[model samples]
Target: MKAQTANGFPSVQLVVVKNGRMIKNSAYGYISTVDDFGEPLMQKNKKPITKETLFDLASNTKMYTVNFALQKLISEEKISIYDKVQDFFPDFKDKKKALFKGKSDITVEDLLKHQAGFPAGAQYYVNKKITQKKKTDKRQNKEIVLELICNTPLIYSPRTEVLYSDIDYMLLGLIIEKVTGLPLDKYTEENLYKPLNLSSICYEPLKKGFTKEDITATEIRAVKRTKDEKFKDIKYMPVHGTVHDPEAYNAMDQVSGHAGLFANAESIAVLAQVMLNGGGYGNIKLFDSSVLNLFTSQGNFFSQAGLGWRRQGLNNSYAWAFSQLASADTIGHTGWTGTLTLIDPKEDLIIIIFTSAKNTPALFGRNLRGKYEGDFYLAKNYGAVTTLIYSAFKNYDNAMLDQMLIELAVGRNELINMIPEIYDNEGSRKDLTAIMESIKEQSKQSAILRKFLKSEKAAAILAEIQSRNSKKSLAKKQAEGQSK
Candidate 1:
């Protein structure tokens, strides 16, 4: 396998798919190194990272937790997608009056959609309220943390907004356990993984045969690195083997619902494939196809949300490679551990890219830069839309322009959404193409379009769109010319 820097940091594997099959799969970078503390983590020999070396999936575990809840619901016909949390857990109704004045208003739908108004992360992990002490040798710790989280107050009312919260999933996971009388991990194993043949996936930490060398690494946090204050100022260092995300680590009783699920590229691909199959692999229906669609459905008031997995569209676009496909109907999740899973239903394909650079302090701090680079976005669209924007400019058409703007706006508003700032910048490409698509779709209305439209402002919007388009063209041309 060949490796390359996605943003600036070196990564191990990069894979791609199109129309339900693999297109590209390559590997790069070293797997192990000697640390500053003299601890040797990762494969010391320049071993090639394979499809089976399980990587800590970080927040991507949200998919599993959500699936666990869905499975429980399937087992019991009583489960309604619209059922509010208060109905199931009445204690939540009035427990946190200061926050969730009416927890009954929050539905299971809201929990998965992130519209429950829970903060992204609750600081309870490091707080004294949650005990880290080992109580009951063989007892699972999630039950203990579940009690703590249920007692914690909601940060805001439900359904008012979508705020990413692992706490929300943690509570949801606990609720699953409570209702089904089974642990989340056990339920998910019986329902999702084994049926899919995702043998490498596991929630527990790697024990004997598996080591840091067997997994891709991620996150460098401020832990017990030094006794002296002088060394405390240093940021992240390369972390391997152990889970580095404090939130996920803590929730798992130092491991969690938010993170800590580990699997390799192959296992992840299998999971993605199963999802693309719409809840079944061969003979088994892990979940109902409609239920799977629910998980991937985009929310109405919000951009998108069906169940645990996010929906396909511009509003929720997470910059996955499949996201930029011209007829893209792809959706997937990204993990805090430099992991990306993109599935295109239209194409019936999945792409899994996992990098270990997040394991170092410098790498951790530079995460924002890597995401902002938008390589996936560029990779997906740069080939197709480059000329469309310029064509829209060449012919001044407001009707065309209006259509483009509306589609792009809808893309931002409803589908694979980018942040406002980034959306405004790159969204122009989609806006331009949408105008062309809409204009071409409507011919008889061309007269009404002419009657309602002006000539000058239309040309101006077209010109502006063209200018941005032209710059990219010139850059591409120059790059190609230089290569020659």
Candidate 2:
């Protein structure tokens, strides 16, 4: 955690839960290393960060808010995943058949899977032309944004490809409101969080009694300007104690379904644990196990796509966000602000890593598309942390497992996922197919590979894997009443 803080982020909070208990919860660093104007601050002057400090959930809001509501609603028989977009909103009907032929056929499942064909984003907060009126009223502004989203043409046909978008969840928030006649925040609080006794997950925390010092700031010098050049003058500045997402702040006024939620580490751990428990915590039951199973289950058509969660598919996989040590059934989501939540039902484990990675020196345009060079933000480094966590579970050596899997006789898919040199090169993919077809007669491998494939050595690795997955251990743990 200290290394990650030194890398770029001012603060990082990590929470791990196992067997429905928070086994680890820790926070390090400060509230902000820089001021609201993006000016650097002296280390001693900065306020201390704590596990209680609220951090913006960013796109993680989609899973907890919109997806959580969808699960409950489906359990209540209020809505089905197969329902059409036109059923809820009149604007999604075939009004522009010539321009967008199949817009209306988009189902609730398509939106959840991010296959509804909407572009990754749209600037609903700002008008495109110079002569347009600037919206001030929050409610009226939301209406304008909704109309714009519905009128905008999709990038492709429904179920074409999984292009993650905020527009999908924005419409979902409206669907919740349409069904319950309550605001998104209010509905989730009453129906989901409050009942589960999870308080820290909420939108508009500044209005909900949280002070600026109580929440970790997402960005410094964060003046959100128009994406369209014509309205560059229209921008909001001095971001602090407010959402860093533009569409959430300027469009829905920090209460949208996509990215307006803020939460603390402990609260997030509880919510994740509830999912691990099959949607029940203590005496409360939010939904049945079937609803949880259905959402987390991998997509039939798109193997990588879960209903709303991210599925950890096998080799030649589309989703590799979770740890390689994570079981194939693991599901999770990440946020733009460098937040991650992973749930592995197979391990009865949940891991949360939240860092204020955006609270660094600002970057200008074109560079916005560039990657963060920090070690904490890189998948390779933090993914190693996840692997270490699994290693700590019963003191098993996963690094050895990974090394062996890479060195010897791995199947095609496992080899592809294990080696980036093979996975990233298009030609290497074709070469691998040929080599695997004639493995025994292929070119000579290193002596280490030959040694590891011996009967005793190979059997040791398999025994470790089988022991980690042993039903006898699971039965003993279950009999113990599941302690931390």
Among the numbered candidates, top TM-score falls to 2
Tens digits of per-residue lDDT for model 2, 87-146: 888887545454545777888888898888888898787655211545553346567777
Model 2 TM-score is: 0.76
- Residue-by-residue lDDT tens digits, candidate 1, 98-204: 64665668777777777776778766656543444445444555655655665666677666667878887777776676666877677676767787666677776
Residue pairs with clashing backbones, model 2: none
Global Cα lDDT for candidate 2:
0.71
Candidate 1 lDDT (Cα, 0 to 1):
0.56
The local distance difference test score of each candidate is 0.56, 0.71
